[model samples]
Target: MTDPADGQAGSDGGHIDSFDDLDIAPRVRQAIADVGYESPSPIQAATIPPLMAGRDVVGLAQTGTGKTAAFAVPILSRIDPTARHPQALVLAPTRELALQVAEAFGRYSSHMPEVRVLPIYGGQSYGVQLAGLRRGAQVIVGTPGRVIDHLDKGTLDISQLDHLVLDEADEMLTMGFAEDVERILAETPDSKQVALFSATMPSAIRRLAQRYLHDPQEITVKAKTATAQNITQRYLQVSHQRKLDALTRFLEVETFDAMIVFVRTKSATEELAEKLRSRGFSAVAINGDMAQAQRERTINQLKNGQIDILVATDVAARGLDVDRISHVVNYDIPHDTESYVHRIGRTGRAGRSGNALLFVSPRERHLLRAIERATRSTLTEIGLPSVEDVNAQRVARFADSITENLGSDHLDTFRQLVENYARDKDVAMADIAAALALETRDGGFLMAPDPPEGERGERRERSPRRSSGGQFATYRIAVGRKHKVSPGAIVGAIANEGGLTRGDFGNISIRDDFSLVELPENLDNETLSSLRHTKIGRNPIDIKKDHGPPRTRGGAKRGGGHGRDGYGKRSDSWGKRSNPRVAGRGRG
Candidate 1:
């Protein structure tokens, strides 16, 4: 296979000038013209040539760089239209992205009537997907989970697959689809070409590429795109414990027509939306688990003024465009800057002024700086609204409420009641009115009192001594020094299996034949079960909650029960050192 010179994309004569210069199928070129695409995007220009030459590729470009066409055009150029089974498979992280990639494939293959593309994902009926598969699609675009389901059921056959594309591979891993993605790749033919694309190359992603990809061509598009000038971006450095309180106070003081709050987990979307609703906001949640019909309804509610706030994950909110979304709140900071860009892009549409607020914890300040450097824009630092600020806004809103009710026909009855009460009790009219107002309020307070001096809204992190006070839980896995497992491998396995980030893990202590890890105390049963079966090399983790003291494989205590005894000293396999990070956040 031929390689591009220096493996870099430029506007010079070294690169393909336009769509006309791409040595792709004639029908695809016609479809490209029909879709009004003229010049090749940087990613497309750098990616297509190697892909057409049947070489593995690793594309590193931020969102909105025409990455879809970069891979789609090339795949469509080479796939056999008359194949009975899928010739190309694309794994996406979310259902929305799956549908989007499938649509792009269909559009590019419009002139090739014999070629068919099928999108399989959660929330869609299996019967429908099975029908499409039976009809023999040439290209399959699917999320990892649903694709795994089909593969296990023997309905979708990719044995003859010639091309495999992992789009937004980092997002898939972040959402806990790493195992599914690996299994799918393992199932594909050995000769299949692989293309892995991500906005950022984290250690996990690099390890995946190293293991699965051949000598892939690497292409990177500098993430220096212009953000909307009308969008005001700001960040608040608040502790994780204070985020909810800060968000509520910000909502009270900020004048917003509509807002979207982005979180990392699907469960978090629902939890945050519920919290917002309890706090009296018209809020709802959307995620990949919801049916397509329900997702559409939720989005429609936002557009038609029925819901003021949408709490969503990155995948659920992909391609979401609402002109009335005046504010975008990053309730949970994204794993990378690419996701941050996508989250804020939901607002600032049609040249309208918008607000983008990011909540960054102290531990995540590095991520904040990364975003700033990548976007080439400095985010203004802001503090959460103080009690006084909230109270002032509330008082103004109360006055406006009184003004709005002045012309109401029912106000005379209440006014007469207040007058009668004042006359009977011989109380001042102002005092009577205040009493009535207090009675009407649920919490019975029109103004907020100032907090104690130096005590703002932030809460201290939990003491490590407290076993379950929002701290880490110790779990023992059956693989350790004897199994030849390193601390990094164990960390990666648990993080991927649990769909957790680095912050979720605290410390790891490896002993002879068994290892102990400190993870978040709130891990659900399903995640624990998944981790129990996760393999480091050839041994299943067999993980379980460690209620007893740490022990060796022979059931004897090694040293003190304290997990951080060895700290940073590396000893023999029987006395390997721990992760060495602090016990709370493990970010030493």
Candidate 2:
């Protein structure tokens, strides 16, 4: 059930290169081929073997590191598709992730038509879930709350469950689902094989593993970066909604022979390609979902100059070597820094100079910093292309076109026709030429209005800060003086786990039973959820929006009501008294 080399995830070992090197079912292998995946990611290569061997595994990996397929492929090999009940159960933190994992299982089991994978989560009708259950599912992927609800209702049974997976385990614990997860674990049979995957390992998650899992094989995948020195790296911080406008503007201003725009999802590749085409750019998409023949054809078109822009996902772009590529644009920032290095490496091949541009959102600055630190090269901050810059390029292109066509035989005929028209209409020849130029521009003016001043250099549309004269929202956490909690520990835990910077937090007031802290208003549900269950020194913060002054509902020490602490506490010097276990490494 466990390996002798337990708790040695940080240790390095030999890595597998291809899926064929690992033990997998024939049908599953065929599915992988159909998906166009030739090689296994580092996490997949390291995780698949131990999983197929039926050993408990604790995988330390990020969200976009191909961890889903890492477990799905091998689990499908062990699954008995003929069985009517659930043989494998996966617990995810959110419904979106639950659906994604279920889709992954279905994709890997495509060759095995008998296998049925079902996703059960909240926000769906109970009737649908019951119907899916009656139809018989070999694999069930659901959120912890819904899974527990099904267990209590006796509608789902896992007494004979053979495989269990906790996807984003740290996220589930941070969302305050610890008790629900334990309840589900208690109902499962002891013989079941468990696999836990988390971006970070906090003490709370480590304790959960220690109590429940057998000697598990701990596998840690660190972000490794290798970049070419000839490549020029730059970044522009913009919001998500403004990325397209920014991308198109860059395409107009930047001179690129051929370019690749990398996005995260397969659907995004197609979606972005369509948008770029609509904007008068020749673009195409390639993803794992595309057929091999179609993918090859698309690549050929890129190499043959049929298309100058290719929008692609990470997996589909692997092993892509195009000498003509002069630019690479990260339209969507990757979740891992290794991906950043790989994406930009597509260009600057064969010792040619290349340019790499990254688009970072306000919330994603941390990832940008991580990439910089890993690559040991600072990305130059760049501003958006001004309207004047775009107009200058357009004018130069118009002039070049005129020069190239001046000597053509066909141009003589057009010149004579234009002269006759000018004589017939008695109009100035210069006016005629200007009218023709307007028509050549598709009836759009060559010069456009300038954007608002400072729009070009606006890096981040920052949220109103609590330290400044801005609105604030008070939140209370369960940990306080009684838990030996410190402000630094609280800030470090929340900032590290919630992806918030030090500036995001405000004043801190530690009470006997609880502590109240002021934060910026309008925090997203996901961030709040993560901060709510984040722990400080072995205790869950249990953070919630404080409606009014925090008052003791039950017995505790005196001075129960929360008072106005103002924004007096410094965000830094949170004191070295911070607990080491409270902080977790940011996913690369």
lDDT of 1 by residue, 193-281 (tens): 99998978999999999998999999886543446688999999987767888899999999999999998767688899999999888
Score each candidate by Cα lDDT.
0.76, 0.76
lDDT of 2 by residue, 1-588 (tens): 011101111222336767789899999999888867777777778888999999999988765466788789889999998899988999987665676688778878899999989988754556888888999998999877668667867999989899999998987776556776888889889999999999899999999899889999998875446478999999999876678888988999998999999986665788999999987899999986788799889889999999999999776786688999999999988766767877898899899999999999787788899989877999999998877888899888888988989978899799899999999999999999889888866766454775564874463345443421135777888987777666655664565445443335666667677777676577778768756655554577788988654345673323422442333222222211242222222110
Residue pairs with backbone overlap in model 2: 336-588
TM-score of 2: 0.67
- Model 2 scores a C-alpha lDDT of 0.76
**Model 1 vs truth, CA RMSD:** 7.0
Question: Top model by TM-score, which number?
Answer: 1
TM-score of each model, in listed order: 0.74, 0.67
Backbone clashes in model 1, listed as residue pairs? none
- Local lDDT at 287 for model 2: 81
TM-score of decoy 1: 0.74
Q: Give the poorly placed runs of model 2, Cα more than 4 Å off.
A: 1-12, 15-23, 30-46, 63-66, 94-100, 121-131, 149-155, 228-231, 237-245, 258-279, 282-326, 342-354, 361-365, 407-413, 442-444, 448-588
